[model samples]
Every structure is written in C-alpha cells, then in structure tokens.
Target: MSLQPIDSTQRIQSLDVIRGFSLLGIFIVNMIAFHSPMYYYDPYSWWGDSINRPVYWWIDVFVQASFYPIFAMMFGAGLAIQYMRAEEKKAHFTSFASRRLAILLGIGLIHAFLIWSGDILITYAVAGFILIWMLKLSGKMLLILGFIIYFLPQSLLSGIMFFASMVDPTTVTYFSSVQDIESSVANYGSGSFADIFGQRVDDWTYANSPAGFISIIIAILPLMMIGAGVAKTKLFEKASDKKLLLSLSALIFLGLGIAIKTSPYWGEKNLAFVFTQDYVGGPLVAMGYMTLLLLIMTAPLSAKLLQPLAKTGRMALTNYLLQSIIGTIIFYNYGFGLYGEVTLMTGTLIALGIFVMQVIFSELWLSKFKQGPAERLWRKLSYSKK
Candidate 1:
C-alpha cells in the first residue's frame, strides 16, 4: 500500500484559509505584548488610557485566547493527516514525526531565547512529542480527553486562587505597581540592546519554568488531540453532511463563548473568570470560527475572495517568524524603540497594516515558490538522510 506524497496541489484550501485567518488574529493579540509591557500584567491598569481602553476591552472579549486554539487544532489535524499518509505508505511514522518535532524544537529554542521571549513554538514542539503517542485514540475519546485535560488543572488552580482571594484580597493582585511599569517602559522603550536582551532572557526563563512548561503542556496537548480527532472524523471534508451539527455548534459555542469571555469586564478579572474565558470559552469560539469558515468556504464567491488568506496560510511558518522579527525590530530598543509608546488603537492599526502587507507578500511569494522558505527548510531537514 504505497501512498502518494503530499504536494502543494493536494493541500486543503479551507485549512490553509483558516490558518491564515488565525495568523491575523494572533498578530493582533501578540502586538499588544510586542509594543508594551502588557505581557507582565493587565495592560488596562498600566497602559490603557481612556482613548484605548475600549479597544483593549473589545480585544479582551473577542480576540484574546481565541486564535491560538485554532492554531493548535490545525497542528493536530496536520499530524493526523501525516499519520494517515504514513499508514498508507507503511512508513515509520513515529521516527519521522520525532525527527520533525526535534527540528521544530531547535528552531523554537533560537526563536525563544534570541528573538522573542513570548515564543509559542517551543511549547508546541514539546507538546507535539507527547501528542504522537495519543494519535491512536478514537475521536470521541480524544475529544473527551482533550476537554478533561484542558479544564481540570486550570479549574483546580482557579478555584484555589478564587477562594484564597476571598480570604485575602492581596493574593489576587495581577497588576504590577506603577513603579515597575515605569521601569519597564524605561528598560524596553529606551534601553540599549544589551538591556533589552537581559530582560528578554528573564522573561523567557519565567515563562518556560517548570510549572509554566507543565501548564502549557496540559493546555496544548488536548487541542492537538482534538485536532487529530477532527481530521479522523473528516469533519471539514464532509462539511455539508454535518451542516446541522456544525450550525448548532457555531451558535451555541459562539454565544456561550461571548458570554463567558465578557463576564470579566462586567465584574473583576478574577482567576476563575480568566480560566473559563481562556480554557473553555476560547476553544468554543475557535470551534465556532472553524465551522463558520467551513460554511463560508462552500460558497464559490466567498472562497474566491478568501484566496489570499489561503495563500497566507500556506506560508504560515515564514510569516510567523517574520512577525516576530519585524515586531521586535519595530517596537523593541533595537530598532524604532517604540515600546510603551504606542496606544492600543495605534497598535491595532499597526497589526492590521502588517497583516495586509503579509497577505500581499504571501500571494506574491506563493506565486513563485511551491512552499515558503521556512517550510521548505523544515521539510528538507526533517527528511534528510543524514
């Protein structure tokens, strides 16, 4: 049973389109951290002036915690596709996937330490190693397991924190002091390259600490498993057949997601609310987005209009790294040194401008190359017979 090698021609347009779509949302979210010290605490307290407060509020409700789940799901779906192909070809799936993830981990390390402290690739690559073992589970089991893994730790942690906060209000503080905020502004906004690099190292260490690593693994592995389940069920492939289910899912998930995610604004941004919004509402909304896109892809006119997004999705790796490079240069001390200077609205506009440029660049690049440069390198290294 020999399977044909997957080529660009065999690529699924909807998957690419969704990936591309997620890129824009991700950039919008990441830009907040890129240009400010928002990653250290709630930006609303320190940086959200009156003019940009509403913008920050809207992004918190609608954009934050949404796109990353979609990206994780797609990654799982991709791995499942690879497994199926390997099975058909009787190839060494585990060995090949291990090699692939290892190379990805190497790339992530450089990206994380040298380029950006907020890198997600390292987490993805590490979680992917565990995902390979769970690829054999049934879709139903995978979904159940994914939900359990996603909710359990966060729920427990949030519950404990909530109770502690009730007993001791000081326990729940997430915002840095004004002094710390001012120091961050000085260090990142006007400091030299060495100063910025030191801060980046410290940030990376905290984010990739033992507990942080464990939490990321718990959160991400399930999404990958659910993605594998989606591929196995061919949910996207038979979209019309599952119209009723998809439609219902979209309505229910989107409605509930909006409700849960916006609850923080109405009340305090407590640990419980944050967990629910990120772990539960985030994935639900991401599912709704996936279903909505699938429905839209069925229409010829809509699909044609979305071709640019598909092209962008195909080059996701290149664009992702490009975003990090361009973002740091633009906002960090090394380049324009605009950190903590841009407002939320201005940052949002910058993200949109970058995305538009990326879309055009993606189309032009894909016209001349079968794969993005990074993607080509990844494949070559993964398959090299060293």
Candidate 2:
C-alpha cells in the first residue's frame, strides 16, 4: 500500500504532551555535561562543595536516568503507531520502517560526530532497527522481555562487582581520576574547536565500542518493546478503561523505583547500586511517569494547560537537535565559552529558559506549518518515492 502522512487532527495530544514533558527532564539532566566535564561528575568527590551538593542530589534523585526511558518508550509507541497506520493502509511495515530508521541513523551520526558526543539519537536509531522485529510479541511477553533485557546485563555486572569488592575492599572505584577530569575540562572548556572536536570524537569512540553498543541496546530496546506493547494494548487510547490498573502501577512502580534509586545516598556509590538505580529503577519510574501522565490527560482541566507542551512534543525532533545546537553554542569554547563556568543550578535555569522559548516557538511554528522542520524532513525522506 502507498504511504500517507498523518494529519494534525489525527495526532494524539497525550503522547505529544508527555513527550514534551520528557524533553524538559532530559535537558535538565543533560545540562550537567553541557556546562562541565562529565568525566568526573561524582557528587561526593568532584562536587564536594556543600551548596551545590544538595542541588546535584535532587537532580540525581528526581531527574537523572528518569526521562530517557520515557522518551525511549514513546519512540516505541511511535513505531507501533506507524505500524498500525501501515496496517490500516495495507502497506509493508518493514520496508517503510527500515527506510525511516536509515534516515534517522544518518541524522544521529551527524549529531553525534559533528554536534555532541552525548547524543542518544544513535542509540534510538539502532534500537529502532531491532524494534521492528519484536512488534509482533504479545504485551505480556514484551513486558517480560523488557525487564529481562534491561536488567540481565546490569545484574551480571553488578554481581561481579559486588563479589570482587567483597574480596578486595579497594576493588571498587566511584569516580574517574583527577587527571582525566582536568584534561576533559581543559579540552572542553578552553581548547580550540579542533581540540574540542577531537575530544568529542574520542568520547563518541568510547561510547560506540562493542561493549558500550551492546549495553545501550540492552538498556533501550526492551523499553521500546514495552512501548510497542503499550501501543498494541491501546493503553493510552483507552486510558479511562484502565484507570485502576494504571493508578496501581503508578503507585507501585514509582514507590519501588524511588526506593531503589535513592539507595546510593545511604551507602557507598558502588557499581552494583548504580546499575540497579539506573538500569532497573530508572525505567520503573519512567513507566510510573507515563501512567501518571495518562491519568492527568484524562482530566478536562489539564487539556488547556497542556496544549503548549503538546505542541512542543509534536515538534520534538526539531527541538531535540535545536537543544544540542543551542547548548553547544552556549557552553563550548568556540561560542560563548561558558563551559566549566556555570554551576548546576545556573545550568538548570538556563535549560528551563531555553525550554520555555522552545515551547513558544513550537506553538507559533505549528500554527503555520503542518510539522516541525526536522520532522518534515524526516517524513519527506522516509516517504520519498513510496
């Protein structure tokens, strides 16, 4: 079947709203690296200063590792949505999805190598390719697989670290060396564009290694599958029907997630605990957030208030790249050279300001155009000659 574009009227407001909300959280977390060297971001060691410690702790407990899963799950939901649309039109799913992901991979490469090393687009694109095959799984199987894929690697690593640390008290290291930290700061903060570009290349290289690649796939792909399961179940579309189940899930998952995530504060920040907090608790909290958003969207009072966020979500691809562009310009040496100069609080405030502007821009832009600029480009490329 021929591919057709989804009209604005056909868009789901809740997905857009939740996606926009996730962007704010993502920026809040990413601002740390944008303004400083992330190689040594240990709160207990690098940020020993008491004043900023609390801020960092709050961000870690509430913001970090929470929203990425939400974004990933939403991506899966998007694939499922596209699949459903394709089925409705009697089109081939794999062909369209493969081309779409190919274009996304190109965009991700440009962003990762040229713009920022911390880009998640490459992971998303790679995971998207894998997600196409798992779309046929039942919701129960998808959820089970999501948990298994996400936790198995972390669990094994955590077990090894725990056992090793028990055998050798000094086996566990919490933060990077001071020399590495200083070098990172120098390269990112004051180095020439070439120097910074070289550093970015190194960072990307480390992140794209076989081990790193597998780790990311295991972490991300399962969430995407769960998201596909959510789409298949029509959970969001039929929110009212599953209100009780969603409410209970929100309570249980968020409670357990918060408990696991906060365990680091009570003890040492070892590899085992870190893995559990991020790999396990993170996705749980993200699901809780999703269900909570769905519940909120059911309320009539929230619809008007959420419209701007929905607009932002509708143009997420454009805004995501824009964040990288604007953030790098603000913090990199080639631009304002504010790297390593701003505190976490200041960085967060800046992120919030940028997000506000983006929301306004999104609302205005959507009024005139059918899709965000980048979204339009992606769709154009994906549907070309279809």
Candidate 3:
C-alpha cells in the first residue's frame, strides 16, 4: 500500500483567512449586481455617481478584482484537500466528492429559489464534478489546461465582440437603459423578502440550464482546476513561493485588469457583456487576485485580516447564503425595503458593516460549533446519518 502523507485533518490558517477575506470582498462587487436588474447597468444607482464617489470607487477598485478569484482559488484548494483526504483514507473519491457536490447543489437550489438569483454555489457544485477528473494531472498540465479553459470562452466572446464592433457599432446588448435597469432592480427589491415564488421557477430553470447559470460553471472550471493544481504542489504552504508569485500576478493580471476597467473602449457595457461573461477577461483578472491573497497570507500581519476571513471561509456555504438573506431583509420591499433607494456610498458602508458583523458572528458561531450550520447539515446529509 502507498504511504499516506502527513495528517490531513490539520487546518491551514492562511486558507481560512483568505476564504473569510474573500467573503467580505465579494460583496463589494456582488452588491452592485445584486441590487440592480440582472441585465442593465447604471452607475448612479448601481454603485453611486456623486460627490461621495471616491469612497465607492475605492471600494470598487479594491473589492471588485479581489474577492471572487480568491474564492475560486480556495475552491481549488478545498478540492485538492478533499482528494488528499480521500486518498489517505483509501476511500472512493468520485463517490465521496459527488455526494458533497450534490449537497451543495441542494443548498444552492434553496439559495436561488428562496434568496437571491445571483447565487454562485450551483455553479461550483456543477463544475466540481468535472474538476475531480483534472485533480490527478500534473501541475504543469493543470496550469496549461487552466489557461486554455479560461480563454476559450473569452475567445468566443472576443470574436463576437469583434464582429459586432464591425457590423453594428451602434448596437449594445448591455447597459443600454436606466429605466429598464431600475425596473429590474425594483422587481426583485420590491417583493417580499422570500416572495420569489413567481420568479423562482424561472430563475431556477435559468440557473440550472446550460445557457444560463451552467455556463458560469463551464467558464470557471479552468480556474478551479488550476487551484487544485496549486494545492497539490503545496504552493500555499510556502510563504516565499506565494510572495514571488503574488508579485508576478499583480504585475501581469492586475495590471491588465485595471487597464481593461479604465479603458474608454471597454466601458460599462463591454465590462458587463464582454468582460464579465464566461468568455471574457474577468476571470483572468480573478487569477491575479488569487495570487495577491497568497502574498498577503504570507505576511504575519495579515493574520488579523485573514483569521476572520478564514472563519468565514470555513463556513463559506452558510455565509454565502446568509448574505442573500441579509440583503433581502435590508433591501426587499416587504422587509426594510431600501431597494433602489440606497446610495452607492451608503450601500458600500452597509455592505462593510454587514461584513464586519458576519465576521464576528462567524467567529463566535464557529468557536462554539465544530462546523458551520450549513456545513454540518451538509455533512450529515451526505453521510446519510451513518
């Protein structure tokens, strides 16, 4: 029999910190998307456009490019860790991972149906099955595959954008309306906090179908696979390695991301349609942000920020769903009904406040409990009460 490696149960502090941090960071970007219509983009109402702007912009820049990638990278790391644990225990990986993924799917379904349409768990669950296969490949192979998958969608999107730019330079499929955008945001924001009954069926269908939510999974699988590769290599375990790579990631991915965001040519429309989609530059930049966190994790000072984040990470599923619930209560017409009314600046503050509260809540919650509420439930279900 092959020798099992070191203790698999040991928790990695850096991973937890990065996870928790990403939880906070993701909301900065997700809030804009969440509060508005799914299709339209309006700066004034979406993120804020006025004198209180610098703060919003600061949040936008810092949080927009930072969190999602870290989450994705951690997903990869988590997958690798699970695989290692399975191997160490001489268990069936596919069966075990599939069970976990299925539970995640169920949780995601509840989130999308009852909470928010912008939920990401379903995508993670779907892509997870495919990611398991890539786990055994070499790091070099996985990295190459990651880039290939990452750009494949972008390649198709770029082709479409190029043709559109040439054929109908005036045509814009995204961000063309303010009123429609408001209507869309209002539709969700104006309803009862949990009154997604009418929309839930449609949203759930869209979320599960290939052209909708599933596309997101296809688009992101590459990054997740790359994350698994990184975990396999023990890259996160070495501070020096993370520092060097993080610097490179900043220069390459972050530089490109900033340039893309600022360029007049890209605009909000392209940013949403061309850049943020499956076949766009957004995920590429996410990769860079992942590196940034690794570098941050290497610094001992980072422990403060990362510790809470790690706790959040440890209970990511619960926290993610909780975000939707919290957002619903605060913004929905049936609840606090702030909706399209909150200024970008105000929303940003609220988001930060909620994040801080969650950190405290999560830390306290975890201290008394072995696993997150949702995580524990998931394990219980997966184990079939064995």
- The clash count for each model shown is 0, 0, 7
After superposition, the stretches of candidate 2 with alpha carbons farther than 4 Å from their true spots are none
TM-score of 2: 0.96
Local lDDT at 313 for model 1:
95
- Ten residues in sequence with the least summed lDDT for candidate 1: 1-10
Which lDDT tens digits does candidate 3 get at residues 172-219? 444446675555565666754444455445545645575765567766
TM-score per prediction, in order, is 0.94, 0.96, 0.85
- For model 2, how does the per-residue alpha-carbon lDDT over 1-386 read when each residue is reduced to its tens digit? 76778898888888999899999999998888788777555655666587678888888777889999999999999998888888888888998899999999999999988888888988999999999988878766777787787778767877787788789847775766577567667877889989888888887876679998887887889889888888878887899788899899999989988987887787668766776777777877888899999988888788778999999999999999999999999988888988889877889899999999999999999999999999999999988564
- Candidate 1, which segments miss by more than 4 Å at Cα? 1-5, 177-183
Query: In lDDT terms, how accurate is model 2?
Result: 0.85
Clashing pairs in 2: none
Q: Say which prediction, candidate 2 or candidate 3, comes out ahead on lDDT.
A: 2
Where does the lowest 10-residue lDDT sum fall in candidate 2? 39-48
Check candidate 1 and list the clashing pairs: none
> What residue runs in model 3 are displaced by over 4 Å at the alpha carbon?
1-9, 41-48, 51-62, 173-195, 200-209, 264-281, 384-386
Tens-digit lDDT string for candidate 1 (1-386): 32334688777788899999999989999998888776567655655578988998888888889999999999988888888778777877888889899999999989887888889898899889999888888777877888787767767776787688789867766666566557667877898878888878877876778987887888889888888888877886888777788788889889988887887777677665676777777878888888889888877798899999999999998999999999989988878999988788999999999999999999999899888999989988887453
Best first by lDDT, ranked = 2, 1, 3
Error of 2 at 283 (Å): 1.0
